[model samples]
Target: MDTKKPYLAIILIQSIYAGMFLLSKAAFDGGMNSFVFVFYRQAAATIFLVPLALFVEWKSLPPLSFVTFCKVFLLSLFGITLSLDINGVALVYTSATLGAATTNCLPVITFFLALLLGMEALRLKTSAGIAKLTGILTCMAGVLTLAFFKGPHFKLFCLHHSHTADTAAASSSLTWVKGCFLMLTSVTFWALWLVLQGPVLKSYPSKLLFTALQCFLTSFQSFGIAIALVRDPYEWRLGWNVRLVAVAYCGVVVTGVTYYLQSWVIEKKGPVFLAMSTPLNLVFTMLCSAFLLCEFTSLGSVVGGLLLIIGLYSVLWGKTKEQRLLNEKCVSTGVNKQGTELTVVTT
Candidate 1:
């Protein structure tokens, strides 16, 4: 695929995430618990991806080794199951706008974790990396300021009687706090998944095959929990409404298509280019949240969102510069070698 294609696909992925937020809200409203909703999404994704995987990667299916299976299994649990579980529940407690803003910090966490693990190198001499890190820090400051600082009350719609203005006003405003924390914790798991999956992706180059295995393994992993928790399997009836349709779209397009695109793009362009596109998702998701779900954006949200974008780009800038310098050095060496070869040949 072309370099610009992944950038375009990421837009689609962000839109799917935005749709997921809404469908999840519908699932919550339709008497489905968090675990139930998560179970459904995973089940749907697994079903959708299974056939697609068989069709696309039939010949390329790798021999499922013990080590590779373990990696994929862990990735499925952490990345797909746990990450989405926390995020889906967190969205229930928090507004979509806040969720979008908070999730933008994902890349910053990823960068630091990668650095600590020595998967990513830090060059203090490279101003780009420093600037990028600085930007990430600055964005963190903005998120903190937005989260902790004072802000006026904004009203949307009241869902339940307990969510009425009078009740909401009287209750301690900490659920959102807890929700954000959960989402952040989820981000940590996801970042770890990405770092760990790097090696697995390198070993198994077929994204479709890997994704299919991961999803199938994760479904079985969650199946045990689903059966243990829900007494009646009849409760797992598929709701083929618009909401379920949205969920299906996310499963097929986001998990299946977008994910494969991301893997291919990363393999082609490297992680730096891929990570840089993180902030764009925030923008796209925020816009979709506003229009699709009628989400209200606060001033703090706007400011915090901007800061997150700044920080995300800073990291990208640093990595891009580092790569550029490395390429220049390679070119210089190649030119020197070519000149010496010509000189020796002529003599």
Candidate 2:
């Protein structure tokens, strides 16, 4: 049971995200403003996280320096605020399934960014390197396929609403392409956030506090963006509706609970294991969107999704093999050094 905990935790996290995609899409379909939704979601997350962070980390909290606070602020701005705001608009233009499918590109994008930042190296001579390169190419191919192709649409066994037809009418080819690129941009920022978190965490060293601080700062940032873009005071109002539910679920469950669970899972099973399960999110989102949202799945989407999954695994495999090789080399070098020292001491 203990051994299965991480798997269960990750599955739960994916399930939460699947619900987020569906709920967010539904809310947007009902004409909820994306910017306002971002603000409310972040505010909700802050409300939930602040007290919990205080309770769990208050006694042992280290004094936060201004520099670290600024870092966290910037992180929140680009990572959560921008990524989510853009993603909401993208979801408005595209289907929840596309949003989920595009997320599979994150690992590949992160790897590419790492290479550019000199944080990772590629050895063309090695099979691992070849796999990584192939994966990158495959992921791009998948993205292109998704963006350009919408083959025959097939409906699942679900209620077909007039709203679905209206949405399809509004989604022109240009809008679909724009949404695809927007989704890509959102994932890029998210990947950047993942890469930058390492150094910030080293400086702050408190996971709970760091996450809470980001959410807190993001709420204010998103609020500013929301108010600037959406001046209609009426748009800010949240009644007893799907908008409210989406905000609450995204803020509390997706942001708050998932963060805690993900941290635990990463600690126990490592990030690679967690990343490998991302395809499960696509699967869940696809099914839920079909049944609940009455969304159509195109042949191109299925084919592209398959390609993206293939790319994700290929990259993960290469990364894992590279790490294993590096560890083995270190062990071999240590053994050789120890033997040499013993020989010299005996002499």
Candidate 3:
């Protein structure tokens, strides 16, 4: 019922993503296999979600049909398995900075997919529409700047024995082009999940149940991948270590909570809103790393972060404006006319 609720969700989601970067990095530093880590993450998420879904959404759960089950399976495959797998591989071949830049394009991909699938409208004729589209581009530009350009060093709390100049150099394998392509592929899979889940959630309508099922299916899917890649039992062993901590944090906070929040947001605000929220992850990451890791930012980061915030707000205003116009139209028409016979958005 609130037009502003998605913003709150976006804030929380981005914070979680930022924290994920730090925690995932620690997990990797501790020599955790990415595949095994993913499997454990989904497995733990499933364990947590099962009881919650069973109890919380039990009454609301719809009968799972064959077609719906297939859809959910595809969702799990793309959303969890394929996207994370490709992302990990991409990181191996490319720098983490490049990977973040690649992910920054989520708004662009999600917006276009939403328009193509008729889930979101391209009201280019209106200022609000143009602002929304341009904002996505602007946000991408900001991220690109932050990723590629480091003007001058700037820091708020980074004085502990470290080189400031080399901060942009995120550790990665040097297969640049291959890594970029893989990263793009992962982004595509992620966007596919974002676009398709809106429709699936409409049909199924049980956020908790579907999310839990997706986690369960993803756990198995990840396990299969892990089996093919990881033969060492030591990698899979979750003892008292940072690897265990990462799994717990990622599973409970990132996947379990973040996925459910995103689903609920898509159901409420549409995928465009969810997609447009990605830039904030960079903002949060910048702040988190600066304080936590004593990492310093550059002039490019300062400029780009400002642009990112502006673009994000512009997009939000555009989307909200469209809703207002649609509401007005509905009131004038005295019927649910589906925004002038266009089902591109539903309130």
Highest TM-score scorer: 2
Task: Give the number of the best model, judged by lDDT.
Answer: 2
Q: List model 1 lDDT by residue over 1-347, tens digit each.
A: 56567677666656666666656665554556666666666777889888988897888777767887777888889887888778777767666566666666777787888889998887676697687679668867866755654256554453333232343234345775676678777778888887787899887877777877777876776666667777776566666665566557656666776676677767777766666666665676556555555555456667777887788777777777887899999999999999999999999
> Of the pair 1 and 2, which is ahead by TM-score?
2
Candidate 3, residues 38-96, lDDT tens digits: the string is: 89988989999999889987777798889989999988898769898888766544433
Give the alpha-carbon lDDT of every model: 0.70, 0.91, 0.74
Task: Compare candidates 2 and 3 on lDDT and give the better one.
Answer: 2
lDDT of 3: 0.74
- Model 2: number of backbone collisions: 0
Q: RMSD in angstroms, candidate 1? A: 3.8
Clashing pairs in 3: none
Best-first order by TM-score: 2, 1, 3
Clashing residue pairs for model 2? none
lDDT of 2 by residue, 1-347 (tens): 99988989989999999999999999888889999999999899899988999999999898899998988899989988999999999999999999999989999999999999999999889999999999999999999999999888887887666375357545788998999999999999999998999999998998888888998899899989898999998888889999999999999999878888888998898999999999999999998888888888888889999999999999999999999999999999999999999999999
TM-score for each model: 0.84, 0.96, 0.76
Model 1, C-alpha of 183: deviation from truth (Å): 0.9
Clash count list over all predictions: 4, 0, 0
